[model samples]
Target: MTLVLDPLSPALLACLDHAYIDGQWLPVTGSERLPVIDPSRETVVAGLTGATGADLDRAVAAARRAFPAFAATSVAQRIAWLERIEALMQERAEALARMLTLEMGAAISHARAAHVPFAIAHVRAAIDVLAAYPFETLRGTTATVREPIGVCGLITPWNWPLYQITAKVAPALAAGCTIVLKPSELSPLNAIMFAQILHDAGLPAGVFNLVNGTGPEIGGAMASHPDIDMISITGSNRAGVLVAQAAAPTVKRVTQELGGKSPNVLLPDADFETVVASGVMTAFRNVGQSCSAPTRMIVPRDRLAQVEALAIAAVAQIRMGDPLDEGTVLGPIANQAQFNRVQEMIEAGIADGARLICGGLGRLEGLSQGFYARPTVFSGVTADMRIAQEEIFGPVLSIMAYDDVDEAVALANDTVYGLGGHVQSRDLEQARAVARRIRTGQVHINHPAWDAHAPFGGYKRSGNGREYGLPGFEDYLETKAIVGFA
Candidate 1:
């Protein structure tokens, strides 16, 4: 399982010292350099610096300046722009995939199969939604027109850097809103490449600007800036709160895709072998880094033994190793801090009396280096346990036994987070009934295919506003009622 770090490519290296601003690579205006660490080897592959105050000011101002014309752009023009961006992204998909693997320890296979492809999917979805959207509607004696919200401040997370960027940017562009993006300082190489893609795709100056910095620096600035009309952020609830607070002074709109401890409830009639195994894999996918990952598995108490056996078998199939290797299924945790957090949560689960079924504490066998984590599973997890309730952004699964359907639903909806949930049932009506009760943005029945256009956001503390599809595109728009204009 020992693997050497992939050497930094020259193109990625060249992207380190500068950023894309006003549609060009500009020198960093700040002195502090943030090292981009490869989580697999815990090595600094490259460095990034935050946009200085003046630099952030310039970028925001540029977006503000370009908003008028961009907002006025015809729908056909916006669609064309999206098509071009999608084409460019498709061309560089493999390179971006590699950058993701190197910069954030995503498995090479995952980066190719899930990460890059889904990112491209978002752009394509935006195009399709925009083409058919009704920008103007007549109601009674008034004409309701949807216009661009104006300059946008986008802050994306490291977990799905490119996907999140495209999720925000593509929709913003399709809605005709110009944006300044602050990608995660941790995994920034892909952002660097993405800015280049925008440039190659001929995105107008200031229509899409890139700035790399910490939340307090670039994120705070963008959220607080009066010229930036809306700020969409995807990260932890803590980060989302900070952004919302900062933006409040300006009365700017803030959209967020934050954390989740989503539930996977297996109904009594569900087949334990198939459902448990699939649930284990789903929960552990992306090393459990996904915001909507089903980390909590709720099952019928009578079938706990059967579920545990199947879950153990599922966990055994996972191959944890170097991200670049084709055989590797689970890679290392993306960063040191997250690595430590996962470890802490695993230990807390043990201390909290949750029975550890397999995998616990420390690196994978003989894998002395890197952030490689043990694919862990815990049974007998109670509702109050930290392992069951908190968002452990690692490959850990907590299995809780429920006495009945009501208890199962209650357990699923118990958390403060309502980002995502899953229900398994043989009867479609039963599944639908259970799905309606869970207080989350989206629910999946029988492990359905991912819908790129479904509206995705959370309820409660998981954050606000939706992303994906027409709703995502429209989130960047403002409504205008032209009175008596029908």
Candidate 2:
């Protein structure tokens, strides 16, 4: 179905070709314009011109100019600004959520329920952190101060466009750091709406800027720019590596939230009927685009058949269709390239002798036009298999069986990624014990409610540093010790 934005404001649509710099919308300098496709129908909906190196220079300069004044603002003043941004976001929440569905093909319900609300929670989270944060403390005759880290370059991904944007932007604003944001070119319209929200909220000029372009062009420029104090990116492993390499010469602080092949371990004694169904849904959330999605399901060896049956039942219930449909549970893959990658991974699973319990390569039976992959489940998946080891970033689940608890932990930690993990058990202590043993940045016991306050990042090749809540807020600040202060 062709997606329509007839109800959207003209001003928001006008933001497509313009970059927000120093409180004004200026036409992008680059002549090359990239088409933004509506993944639901595989049609061009809008186009964005890339920001040139010169544009990056101007953005950096504006942020640098604003940093000193912004950084020196009173905590109360910054808090008030954050509150304003939060209120404006709430006022425009529906528009922001709809933009997400149009650009990234997220189900309207999912966009409204998880994407927008979770993003708003980050702003609220920043407000909470800023209210009580102690910027200065005394020790003997010395005073320790946490100050803003000048300017930050933020790069967000397309999978969770607005969610990832606010995850970094809100906290950085709260910490008093000026920003230059390069949102994913693939799904950038929501980001433009976000820029408008910040503008209307009365954010100081240069405090938050949005530039849309390719990773190689805009992202590369931001990383190597000397004026940028820190670079935080949420993207792929390859992209993270390139950013770190580019920023190495500047000696700037670089933080990344990259790829994951996170595992969901089902303790032998756990309620299989309940946990297996929930596990299948968690892995398939967002059409399985989440970096921290638990795509690997590790279960007891003997109950493999039972788990497989439960998984098949859950997959059958997922309703994949038009993202605009309120009842649709799953939407198309966010873009064409990702759709191709997912198909290849599913083919690899079959070729490697993994049992395809349900679903497989190609689009859902009737979804011939859009980028839709069948919700797939594979049994007899060994840890060494490519499907089990790689981050498919689609609705593909790999089920592996373990002989014991030690084996279960080993299976869960087998991959190079340590971004997120899940442990399920009726016994709270046992679940906690297993959670501790899983070598990931965050572990969820029995699929608990998402805590926006918890620090989120990675442990291994998944990338470094944290985002969300206090740690995320502090990541934008630097420490200084004033000796002889007393």
lDDT (tens digit, per residue) of candidate 1 on 1-486:
111112366655665677677877778879898988888888887777767778898888888888888888898998888899898888878888888998889999999999999999999999999999998999899999998998999999999899999999999999999989999998887887777777877778889998888888888888889888999999999999999999999999999999999999999888776888889889988899999999999989989998888988998898889999998887889999999999999999999999999999998898989998899999999999998889999999999999989999999999999999999998899999999999999899999998899999999998899999988988998999999995
RMSD of each: 3.2, 2.4
* TM-score of model 2 vs. true structure: 0.98
The C-alpha lDDT values of all candidates are: 0.89, 0.92
Candidate 2: tens digits of C-alpha lDDT, residues 1-486: 112223246766676667899998988889888998999999988877888998999899999999999989998998888898888888777877888888899999999999999999999999999999999999999999999998999999999988999999999999999999999999888888788778877889999888888999999999999999999999999999999999999999999999999999999889998999999999999999999999999999999999999999999989999999999999999999999999999999999999999999889998789998899999999977999999999999999999999999999999999999999999999999999999999999999999999999999999999999999998999999999999
Task: Please give each candidate's TM-score.
Answer: 0.97, 0.98
Model 1: how far is 288 from its true place, Å? 0.4
Error of 1 at 450 (Å): 0.9
lDDT of 2: 0.92
Quick one: best TM-score, which candidate?
A: 2
